[model samples]
Target: MALLINHCPVRWHAIYHSHWTALQYDQQSITYQQLDQLLSALQRQLLTQINLTTPPSMVRLACIASNGIELLLMQLLCVRVGWLFCPLNPRFTATELSQRLAVLNTPYCWIENEQDADSLPTSSPQLQIDFELLLSNLHEQASSSIAVTTNISTSAITLTPLLIEPEQACNIIFTSGSSGFPKAIVHNYRNHFFSALGSQRLIPLASQDHNLLSLPLFHIGGYATVLRTVIAGACIHLTTYPLTVALLQQHRITHLSLVSTQLIRLLADPLFNAKQSAIKHVLLGGSAFSEEHLTALAARGFHYHLSYGSTEMASQIATSDNSSQLQVLPYREIKTHRGEIYITGETRFIGYFRDNAIHKIAAEEWVASGDLGTLKQHKLSIIGRKDRQFISGGENIQPEEIERVCLQYGRVKQAYICPTKDQQYGQRIALFVLFSDSTQFDLDCQQLKHYLGQKLISFKQPDHYLAWPLKLANNQALKVPKQVFLDSLSKQGLT
Candidate 1:
């Protein structure tokens, strides 16, 4: 029998313990009862802190920490207390982090420790708390006889656990911001609840399943996995990065979420043998999958599904069926206007949070996804990002179209096409490729150009062939920052 999700509304008599495992990290496994106990205790301490300073509704808890039990618990605590949980990427450099914090203008920021807080540029005056120390204090207080409940309740707290509404804003996620500074995307509890339900319609999650927390909590995919597990009463295995096949087998992970880069690394890992994997279902997203990667998974008999989504829609808007055609998932609507994708539905985010307020989307307004795609017979095929399309010699050129052909050439491992200023064509295509091997191919630029000519029209063909940028070649990010490539081109006098 499945365990009950504590977040769901329930009758007073229906609340019961099931002893089902809720979380597993390393050797420690936390059951549903234990998880509820921890959250319940943490709630009082958190409430006391909030009541002492900011009201719960006005609280914007911006957290900078790695993925772990502590981070996950904080997310749950925010949900229970009706605070907007803003989890920033800890891997970002100090400058990057400070810039993001400035945009948020958040009232409170939580860091792992004092060292982490000291690293940031203190241009803004926001309350910074040591989250690890806060957790330790909570643990200490829980063991003490001092009644913390009265500390918060006696203070005339404006927010209470019972007051948390599903319609209230709950999460703030920053976009990748390949072109500019990341936008703060806000999601309500209803968005997440429907996102999980929509994904469950295509990808079934059972109580017996153990999903690997492969993605970070900063990304929508990672947070969605948490809720998906909760809604299914399943277990989420929280482990460190570089997930090995041994760990998968050890944890008995049944469901996995991965991006294209992670999938490639796994396929290349000498320790990875597909037949030995305990992973039954793999959900792929983040970017477009190459034909090479797809063929590799297919040959290995991997039951992988492709997903297309964004932070605005919560997580997955469409999931691939058995035939691998992306079909619109439940609770989300996808339509094309002049070949550009527009989205709206129950799972759509509230809006972009900025300037200390939510810039909400008008009711029944469709969000322009900035993605160009084609829909045929209820199946969607993503062409490319609309912003990435450039005009060359009065003809439109989509880099993805050329990149797709380059990947099909068999020698290219990854391909990216960017626009460069051209004296003759106004804007010309520049192709950067990562060969299957790190070394350059025997075929020179002329040969590559000749090959592309056969596959693409002369106007769409790249005028410049260059090696992949060194900085991005080693990037572990799910999506390559296109602006970085533009910078590289500027340095090389190509733009």
Candidate 2:
């Protein structure tokens, strides 16, 4: 018999046995039984509060919360009921949330706190379910005399069996919307399950292991990790605070997933040494990583797994194990058409949600990833964005390629490649760099120009250099708006 989404076969094992530790938060450990019970209670409340007699034809639940047991439980409840779960980033402003919410036409929304509820537009009729109140209610019911009664009409609330077909939409994750408003990408159970399973095959996971949950539950990277751990019956350590070197040590975290910027910070910390035996695997992606960064990780004895993935792909397209340098996994395949990477395999997403503007693939399909790469020696190396490429004096240059090289410098914290007008070159390449400390780092424009000249061809070198401080989004620190940097440079008359 095929596995279904509503009734995950794993749940049977989870219900009977309590050995699996589902979550650790605030120094309190929650077992699988506790998690299961919590989910059941939440589901009951949802049914009663929403008057859900039957699951919607197109199930969609909008969840807005940070990383915690509550967020995990909400997702699990949705999966158990075959509901389409949409996890929205808590950091998004009300206007941003409204735009995304409008696309889904979600009937119910779960939010972190009352502040989020207040921020929501009054005109929007969508019900805002307070997470704290819901939790309090669940706790009260669990502790009350009503807990002894098993007479609640479970029959009215039908527990839909999980019959996940290959094509059914499981969830819709929106992009970061840095360039424009975020697009909702629809992924099925197969897409998420395959990503987790494929990753496990490459980097072996055991029931004894524990994974640190620092990534936002809204993003695919963070969301996929939760699914992977639950399927593996492993423990997830949830941290409300930011991921720092001290936190990793405090938790004795074995596995972690980080973006390039996070890894750079970890590497800079004096206490960060790969020789420490506790950490097992550090998966890095989300942006281009410098060759120097890879080499440094290797030198420190830290096991690094480089991945190429996006919201549309569900998480990882191609992953390499650090044990053998950086080689693509055996089961994965990669090919480039017109410099764009096209991935076809079990781990691909079903399609984008609601919007039919984008073309769809036929049955047994593949995704045309907008990002570019080249496959060499059974390994894939990312070049740059095909759309971001600009022309300079009849010569074409990829800014990401140049930025990758610039990031190799130890003092440079982050870099962006933008195009500026030049009378001689037509359109000259410009570099915006963020340094660790301006006082200590004395490298000037001339020195940077010479450095690039030695490493790159004359046409590829950035003609303009601007030193700027890094500023992150108010909600999510990981995302930096490229337009903001460009505007700043233009204001200073540097562009």
Q: Write down the TM-score of every candidate.
A: 0.88, 0.86
lDDT of 2 at 9: 30
Residues 159-221, candidate 2, lDDT per residue (tens digit)? Answer: 333333434565778887765667787776666776777788666666777888767878888
What local lDDT does model 1 show for residue 407?
Answer: 78
Highest TM-score, which number?
1
| Candidate 1: Cα lDDT at 110 | 72
Error of 2 at 263 (Å): 2.1
Candidate 2 Cα deviation (angstroms), residue 163: 6.9
Q: Give the TM-score of candidate 1.
A: 0.88
Clashes of 1: 0
| Candidates' C-alpha lDDT | 0.76, 0.69
RMSD of candidate 1 to the truth, in angstroms, is 5.4
Clash count for each candidate, listed in order shown: 0, 4
Clashing pairs in 1: none
